[model samples]
Target: MDTLQILSEQGVLGSTPTVRLQGEALDLSSYARTEDAEHLRSLYSDMFLVRRFDQESTALQRQGQLALWVPLTGQEGAQIGSGRALERQDYAFPTYREHGVAFTRGVEPAELLRLFRGVTNGGWDPRKSNFHLYTLVLAAQCLHAVGYAMGLQRDQLADPSLPPAASIAYFGDGASSEGDVHESMVFAASFKAPVVFFCQNNQWAISVPATVQTSVPLAQRAEGYGFPGIRVDGNDVIAVEAVTRWALEHARSGKGPVLIEAYTYRMSAHTTADDPTKYRLSRDELEWKARDPLLRLETYLRSAGLADDAFFEGLDTRARAAATELRESVRSMQSADLEDRFAAVYAEPHPLVQEELAFFREYEAGFIDDGQHS
Candidate 1:
């Protein structure tokens, strides 16, 4: 199918609309009571800051400050909208490129850089933020999310005082093919785990196009597991948020898991190491650019008079300041001691770990005082 036809079929482009609250030709009442001005402004601010964070990290990688960086430029709406839908008790298991979701979860941008900088395995405590560490291995976190959801179910049954909670597993179209995701869905279905399988179908999984991922829509896979699946216009933040909210609520209420296929496009390279020019067409990129998430929301804000020059100008200033702070923080980060790597290899000292540490020490001792090989 053509790009326009595919997107239109998925409710991402052209005439058939998905749920939306703020848009040029859309009625707000159809979604919910019109979102208050403050709420709308907050959503815009979150998207802007996350985009700035992404840009700063990409620059850092280019400057050799970070080992690698994953850019989430075009997927901001899908991440932010679904992230904001989570309740405080809910948990999220994210793939490496969920900077926007991490932003919504109250994680510091600098902390997220620590892993990419090779300073730590995980930059933050999952318990503290209810956001799991970035999972580098594809689809691994989906299993973890399902297990955690089962635990939440047990806890809720054991203690009535505890609020209902659900878990969200964030993966991409590429990771969906992994056996781990399939196993996770099977276990979740059999156990009726309260987990949401949130797939960001960004069109391209690394260099491979979505056409190669599956012949049918990714959402339809949920039906085989005995659950409902939804396809949302991922670029439409309002629609994403609404759909995610409903999905989360359904799971939290003990209706079992839901799979959300967020039909979106990856406007940037998959990661800093990738070059989209090698595989994707320039025309396709330009077409998706017109459907930019931030631009559409900005249009709604301006049309509704909810935001003005002062608001935009102030937002720009804040985004720039945040980016500067992030860059400086990453550059100023100190490397951990070599011994520190072995310290956490085992909870307690293990014979194998000790032997490896000794070998590492002996290897370091071989270096000459002049910093040349002896």
Candidate 2:
């Protein structure tokens, strides 16, 4: 069946309002009161910094400083809002493009560059920040998140006094097609795992459009798993934050899993190596640009008199400084020794690893002794 017909049949396109707060025509009373002026400005700053960082990373990739970069240009609101909603005790599993989420979780930008620069297998300690490493394998983190949530359930049962904790699994519309996501959701439902399946439906999964990904709204899929699901305007940071906070609370209070389908757009290429112009039309890009997350928040802040030019200026300065620092760090990054790769393969010494390492050493020695074969 066609996507529209399928959505109609499933009643997935029913009148569930997309949660929105800051927009030209939206009623803000329902959502605007939750955050104070300072908090609003902070959210704006977070979005600004993330965008700047994304731009810098893209530039670095273009300049040949990095091997690849996944741009999160149009999805800043979805990432920042949902990311900031997490508690310190909570854990997050991110897909490879969750740069804004990492920023919100206190991950250093330089550390993030380490992975893209090919200097490290993983960047930063997951335990230290409660934010797991980026999973390049599509939909793999969803299963990991569900398992972690089940473990958290067991841990909570052992110590009732422990503070409530939830795990969030971040995936994309593309990954939704993976069997692993289905299995994760099924297990989460059966086990009543305290997890939030956060899907950033950024319109395009590489070159494929959302229309091809599924027939119904991605959020509606949660109902099949016997959990509540909601759609939030992913470009509206206020709405994203409000919905995420509510979802997190529900899961933390033992309500089981919740699915949040963030309706957003991928304004840039899927990655540095992609060319969106080959598939997506310019008119669609223009439409999403008008609904830019950063622009909406900045407009709201200015209209409400919540922030002044000085605040914006200072923020810009900070962003530039941060970008400079990241560039310098990435350029100065030292490559790991070739032996370190072999050494990290096993916790204990292994004969196979030793043999491989020996072979590699002999090969290097042969190259060093003379220009010709030894």
Candidate 2 lDDT over 265-361, as tens digits, reads: 9999999999999998999899889879899878878987889999999999999999999999999999899889888999998999999999988
Q: After superposing candidate 1 on the true structure, give the runs of residues whose Cα lies further than 4 Å from its correct spot.
A: 1-12, 19-33, 370-374
- Number of the predicted model whose TM-score against the real structure is largest: 1
Whole-model Cα lDDT of every candidate shown, in order: 0.86, 0.86
Q: Write the per-residue lDDT of candidate 1 for residues 1-374, one digit (tens) a residue.
A: 00111234434466556432111132223333235788778888999899989988899999999999999999998999899989999999999999999999999999999999999888999888899999989999999999999999999999979999999999999999999999999999999999999999999999999989998788879989998777777887777776788788889999999998889899999999999999999999998998888997898889888999999999999999988888889988888887788888878888998899899888888885687777
Local lDDT at 54 for model 1? 91
Shift in Å, residue 223, candidate 2: 0.9
lDDT, model 2: 0.86
TM-score of each: 0.92, 0.90
Q: What lDDT is reached at residue 335 by model 1?
A: 83
RMSD values, in order shown: 4.3, 5.4
